[model samples]
Target: MYRIMIADDEPMIRKGLQKLIQQSGQPIASLRLAENGIDALNQIRESCPDFLFTDIRMPKMDGLELCRHTAELDPDIQIVVVSGYNDFEYAQRCLSYGVKEYLLKPISKKTVEAALEKLVYLHSKHTSPAFVSVHRLEEWVGEAEAAIWSLNHETLVKVVQQARVEISSHRLRLHQLIDLLDEFTVLLFKRLHSRDIFLFTERAPLHAADDEDSAWSQFQARLVLFFDELRMKRRGKLKDPVEEAKLYIEAHLAEEVSLEDVAERIGLNASYFSQLFKQSTRETFVQYRTRRRMEKAKKLLAQPHYRITDISGEVGYADHPHFTKTFKKYAGCLPSEYRNKLGIDR
Candidate 1:
């Protein structure tokens, strides 16, 4: 859906265009009106309109001035000049701004239709190509590690491919950018398997577009906005009911922290909490707790401070036999083999 803005000092022209645009039933999903260039500038700043229709002349600020402002604001905004004159000089000047189509006023629905058709087509080609988005996603992730902390060749290649395939079903939009920040926070502190790919993809889109300094400001804003959105969502504090349940599981990994006890503490039905936890994290509560244990188990194995039996107990396996099977499931190696590899720091 394209959002369109019409800027004209004349009330009749603005209203008439708005009505004509709506009546035409064109592809434009939303239409906004600004009485003059000043009002139009505010609208441009607030919401980046997909298209702008402006008269060539106005009193305090002319259309040329508006075009210049809009260019500084967002170069991607498509402008279609509405003029009552046929002066080629003005046309030549507009070419510098890359105006889409200069329409002579006393305009009809047909002229507006043609302008929208061209604008929409151009936007798609520039912004939404399938392979281009995927390629950009990959390149963005691959570059991020170099810009911050380098990844090994194996990890770099693996991460970019994982990011491309696992960006979630979520689509990017101006508003959803807020929620993404919250998601980022969750990913940062949450337990991650070696395969978790989000921190790579999370920054990929921004890296694809801006430098570190500029992107950092925007990234922080997204997080702030997300907290605001969370307040809205919970109607109070960002009520994450599953948090306590996760905490309890972590505290009692060896004791068989069943879904029943964890869910009961959160005051939610056990089955329902189980589903929501899985839905949000892509891992069931049991699986996540076990994975966390295994990760701890690996870290302990790497350290020479603890013996193998002690490490198994540390990761919540009372029986070394049980720890061995679980380690094999995740590591494809017995606990002793993994421990031996760590002796030389492989």
Candidate 2:
């Protein structure tokens, strides 16, 4: 059983959250509600609750200030920021203060339940010493972080799986195992952020399972999926901006194209785009466009139906002599001579 507190200026929000938590089936020994941060802080001083739920904006001692105070008073208390504001800065600030969860407004019952499950697991981990020690867990997390940074999928998965085996050998309850896994995830997130990866903003919610084996399997699958995403991002394979730019260039090859135009279209600065384009394609944007234009002109020249001047206009060159000069440089022969070698004449 655990004690919980909810602090918000809105009566409806406070009551609604209280009802949701009660129905969540968590082991709540007592639940307290406060209309403002000041009241919540006062209640916390009287008796610090196991968990604190608060809104960012409130009369007298806003939630941010309250979080600071609560962290100073009791670092053990798990704080969840239930704010209507979806600003990233607020969420980042709350995380800095060791807030466990940050839920946006219009909260859903499922989301609340998921958060409670993880927070309760955290509380149990804190109160019990039978589980792994802080130092050992830190060592495991450090190993996992190194593996993740190096994109060593095998070693990373092995590290987590080995930890799970040790935890299971202790014969902990199903929820405790699940909670410990969630705690490991939170720690992993913090570690990766310190390395500048920043893949996850919060601990991912676990899937509901009735048994330990199923729960463990689900967790393993989630870990594998996360690793795949990390690998792709590290390799620059996921949503490649250069690939997008290349597709745009291919489609508009016949139109007047500039590096600046392509960069702005793809939402990147012109200079950065130039560098990325060269790195990905091994050619400058102008070189690529020119090569593509010459390729198209050669294909059209083989037909003998289109005039060289018309081919020039088709490839975005209104100046016939300029097109001929570029084609000669690209193909090692004048356009007319190349056509003659193909056994076509106009």
Candidate 3:
């Protein structure tokens, strides 16, 4: 079974091709349609299709550019250009972009079936028994590891799904599929360990299944759940350090605070902590501290009994004039001006 996408500007063409493909009795697992090249590319990025049937000219991005990007994204994808142009230059360019077939407009059932037959043959040839070696398991594991590190759940799930499909299509024995999944899990464990991820504790072993489909389903579920746990653990782990630093900063808002001081208090390297803080809060440590101090100064300025000079000292500013300048920059007015605008007499 193949997942297919059709891209064309004409609604009638898109619907016609979809109908013909459905009626062609091809083993299609799913079908998608796109009104333009850009929409097709976006759909491809979310979930890659086994085959792409696209028109040459569309709004936003053209077919040539879509073909180029699709080739870059997944060279293994079989592309069929369903354009009305019938231009030699377009065919030549598509060939260069690795398009498997080009069908001219006014497509008939015979031509569509022929293209599908050729594409199916090519697909089967590519996924032959010779291609399903033990090395393929390693490739999947490598791809899964990269996805896990990047925290891309969609890509990770897609990798596992592809593995299942390939194993099922190749008719690997139940035992062979289990062995492949076991090896994949072991490899992921070692790779994640090397990166200090350490997700092995309290993990359950793979479940046994009598059928290959059941085995694949169990493996997929276990792997995805494992990744979900890893994501949550890492997320919480990352937040702990940043949260500790934030608490320490809040506690010392009225005192001199430096990035190094907070990093040391949180037991993280200064440079790493700086990067992590910015990534988490979208603010540098200095910027966060300054903003907090200004917020405190604003509250103090609003109190009629608090002198501006005393307010500056209370917010970790030893120099009154400097605090007044910073307050002007931050709030668009000096401390006295701000209080006066608030209708408070000092």
Give each model's whole-structure lDDT. 0.67, 0.81, 0.81
Off by over 4 Å in 1: 130-346
1-346 per-residue lDDT for model 1 (tens digits) = 6789999999999898888777766677679998889989877766668789999898778898898888876777889999998999999888788788899989999887787789888877765622224354435533433322332345534543454344433334332233343344344323221234322112222322222234335554333332222333344423566566677777876676678888787666675566557645668887899898998888878877778788888878888998899899999998789988767332
Checking candidate 2 for backbone clashes, the offending pairs are: none
lDDT of 3 at 3: 85
Worst 10 residues of 1 by lDDT: 199-208
TM-score of each: 0.44, 0.38, 0.44
| Candidate 1, position 72, lDDT | 75
Model 2 TM-score, 2 decimals: 0.38
Report lDDT (Cα) of residue 30, candidate 1.
Answer: 71
Off by over 4 Å in 2: 130-346
Per-residue lDDT for 262 in model 1? 84
Q: By how many angstroms RMSD does model 3 differ from the true structure?
A: 12.6
Check candidate 1 and list the clashing pairs.
Answer: none
- Say which prediction, candidate 1 or candidate 3, comes out ahead on lDDT: 3
Candidate 1's displacement at residue 224, Å, is: 8.6
